[model samples]
Target: MTTPSARVVLKPKRARPLFAGHPWVFAQSIARVEGSPEPGDEVEVVSHEGATVGRGLFNPSSAIRARLYRWDGGPLDDAFWKARLETAVQLRRDVLGLDARNSAYRLVFSEGDGLSGLTVDRYGSCLVALFSSLALHRRRDAILDALRELTGAEGIIARPDRAVAKEEGLDVGDVRIVGTIPEDLTVFENGLSYKVDVLQGQKTGFYCDQRENREAVARYCLGKRVLDLFCFTGGFALNAAKAGAASVRAVDSSAPALATARENARINEVANVEFEQGDVPKILERLKAAGERFDVVICDPPKYAGHARDLAPALGAYARLNHAAVDVLSPGGILATCSCSGLVDRATFRDVLANVAEHSRRPVQILEQRGQGPDHPVSAPCPETDYLKCLIARVG
Candidate 1:
């Protein structure tokens, strides 16, 4: 008869607006299943009205039940991959003008580019591809082939070190796809050089998401003695020092990241920065106890909340970090704080900062607020569209 169909049919309530182009289908929204489907199974998503909405990978265990890859009812063959890969490359070149810059940039940004859960970063001649979803990991050969055929860059490497893969029930592994991917590479941003450790560093070697934020911070850091807390690879510290900061101390627990941070400073020939490897909380405590104050402080911590349940503890961490940051700020000094946790919305982050200021008894005025750079665009209807939230405030 018919090949045993594996698909999900949404209920009326579940399908109401999903057909409107939302990429995510929540687990609670699933109404019925036509046949047995394993996690990461490719399926046809249908509305209650019996209209096909899209083709996606189904992950029953995940809150995100389905991640839509193509809304048009079409075969996902080699042609589809070729077209999507080309479009992804062209978007960066045509829309973001990435060709004019030699610095690293996101080649693919998951759902933002309509390719769910696939992230790629280009560092000089090297490429780091992150395949977090089982759907993409299964098709790793084709994806790698597309990268080789399309970009023709020097090298392509796989970065499955991210935690997202574990949620998809996949084991993490690092694979070298093509060419010679170095252990350490250098990237230029805003005329400053940063040494990136692709094998061990965070998210595809460098924080491409913070490109614009670093540029903005560089504008205000001149003549300031800055303290960068939770400074992985010292992106902010380098920016601040390159902007003529009197001095900068970059702190992180990973000695490897700090070592790269030091090399990054040296690459830029910026001599004013110092790297300290330790726990950020303890370091902050010691600094405050030592009566050491800074004219500018940057707190860019990792994701404290991966989900809604983690928000309480995340807020506590944010508050404690900002409290110490504020306590050691010189009068009228600036504090640039950021939270990468998608669960921590802008409102919640601002509230926590205000609470920190209140607790520290410091008079604070917010100078500016920013989200992820233009490269990381947000969809209007999706709350998850925005992730990075940063606040630049002056404390007295």
Candidate 2:
């Protein structure tokens, strides 16, 4: 291994997590820096006993002081990046067969793909890259080059997350265009086609992570009344409709999303879906007051808690949402609920569901527990990668 230009020594007993293969090294664990290193520069991490732990990108400005990419202290050069990008793309192509059925899929899943703070999603001929760390943003050019060479994509766009960029103190430009990208492109998933607005759409145009979950939920919707809450772009609702649901009412707070969902219904020739725009909680209350009940209800809200500090309130919000969902569910009805908050673990989410069922006076039996599809693989060392949690239960 080549010697790094700078070094960080961990305080006594602070190197245990690093030895255990945890990628992050907090600022508190760093005792000292041997040489001056600019933010995003590669640095060697050393234990207090003088043994090298690993090499990683260093940024003193952030709470996460270092993000180790390799434990063997390999050189982080152009070749290394190219090889990693190639391996990631090949895995999607060979293992997942992403292009066989769909043109949209996750190409790199940050820590899951061994590239922390970086995510790349492919939509048709376009590739959208999101950089959540200063180090990855600084090395975007090399990464983009590798992606272009490996995928032969028509265009590559940078979609830096605003909140994360602010937290990391990175000044990333907005919606950088690398090549030609269409304003509207259609992609196929699970035998369904939907139009995607890559530039303005949420999170790389669509929620490809929910691909498998939507298909799974469709099985229970056949000939049943379905209610899809927070139904952005009608992924679940449309799938339920395609599965021969007697009726499907999809609700969302965004008018634009509802408009897109309507268009999706038209394109797929699914006429059983009704799109409604309003606050989900208020709509649920109104539906309950009107004695509206569904055989299958899907409650998939956005992340309620982004950090650990907000877990308490987030749990309350989740419980309320599930309670409302359960209250509107008919006897022997199925409820497919989801939480995307990384701070809320699966066990805690299950507990929240149990509490909701208890408070609503509805007994429920667990049907299935699901998560993000295979393309968004989770790294065992990084629990944050395992964020999406979907629980399917039958309420009596």
> What's each prediction's clash count?
0, 0
lDDT (10s digit) by residue, model 2, range 1-396: 578889999999999878767788888898999999999999999999999998899988988888888787688888988898898999999998988878889999888888888899999889999888888788888999889999999999986776587778777465577888987788888888888877777777689889999999999998999999999998999999998899999999988888888998999999999999999999999999999999999999998997778999999999999999888999999999999998999999999988977788888888999999899998887888899999999999
TM-score of each: 0.94, 0.97
- Taken over the whole model, the C-alpha lDDT of each candidate is 0.82, 0.89
- Candidate 1 segments exceeding 4 Å error: 1-4, 174-176
lDDT of 1 by residue, 1-396 (tens): 122158788878677566766788887788888888887677888888888888888777677778787776776666787788888888888988976874788887776777777888888788898887777677778888888788888888885646786787667764656888876677888787788778777778788888888878777789999999888887898889888899999899988888888887777788888899899989888998999999999989889998879989999988988988888889989999999998889998999877977788888888889988766767664567699998998888
Local distance difference test, candidate 2? 0.89
Highest lDDT scorer: 2
